[model samples]
Target: MVVEYEDSLEESSYSAAAHEPQDTARLAINASRQDDLADIIFLANNRRVTDMVASMPHPFTLEDAKALVKRSEAGHMGNTLFAIRMKNTGRFIGAIGYAPSMEDGGACHLGYWIGEPFWGQGYATEAAHAMVDFAFSDGGISTLTASCHVNNPASRRVLEKCGFQFREQSKMRMSGNSGLVNVDRFSLTRSTWKALKAWGQAA
Candidate 1:
């Protein structure tokens, strides 16, 4: 089914974070809507959660969610964005999306975040796998990149499972924490993903 959401976001500014899940939590990713504001605020209100993402505003508020939904509903030209939800219950877990990165020579960057309560269930991996598969299969994206705080091993594992290769380590000012932090970057090329698929190294 074609995904649905009401918000539009800047590809350059859609935000970033680490999201993962266990092998059994099959998540259904879809577009973000205004109605999700309450859910978003409730789950994203934690300081610990915000500290790890690069773009999420700490004290994530109703206004923020409103603006996100309003702008996102308006539209972003080349970005494919969405919210992550439980497949069966349609419960909101977090968010995931891709935006074209001009500095990366037009490669799309993959980003996602799952609620703390939902972590370790492979939901992040499931969402990433779904997004990566769609981006290549239907969106025509050739390359995808991602990053996580150097301290976040589970987040890195999510990318590894999806076939992203670790590229480098760097430091950046994290928006959520308002501080500079170390991070590890990774990337996956369309060719590599296809090869992995053929060899069954990735799903």
Candidate 2:
């Protein structure tokens, strides 16, 4: 899918962070919507549940949001974040994207969060599946990895539902904020994806 957005930064960099899986059929990752900051801030600030997302907290201020927009616009952080919008409402319901890994070639970490009001509606699953498909198909990525805080079962379920397998336990030393948190690593491979599709068809 050729997902185009007006907020795309002209400059960006990417690298592999973890074990690179060989796969095809990756999603077309893109940038966040520039003009929709007000709505993003409103949803993010008003929704306490959104605090589950690392880096964003309840009462997210405009200052913090401005920084987010700036970082997204700069596009040099190796993180390709995109806003999720409803085709009908054109409202920004959430965000999802891949953070290029610093450790391995062709490997990227997936991250996403949805607004509180939109939970349990399958949007997260659909968006995540689209991203996985892009990573494996379009990005030519062999392996895609994601980490969720040990306490975040919903996030873990999202990853598993999309075919990622539990890999290992690890800790994330997040920058400039929360010190450290236990995280669970999950991964998916091209062969596994193929098998998943085959299995789906069989079922």
Question: lDDT per model, in order?
Answer: 0.71, 0.63
Report the Cα lDDT for residue 190, model 2.
67
Best by lDDT: 1
**Model 1 segments more than 4 A misplaced:** 1-25, 71-77, 102-105, 201-203
| TM-score of each model, in listed order | 0.81, 0.71
Each prediction's RMSD to truth: 8.0, 8.1
lDDT value for model 1: 0.71
For 58-133, candidate 2 gives per-residue lDDT tens digits of 5677876676666555553335566677755567777777776653344778878787888877677777876665
| Alpha carbon lDDT at 167, candidate 1 | 92
Candidate 1 TM-score, C-alpha based: 0.81
Give the candidate number with the greatest TM-score: 1
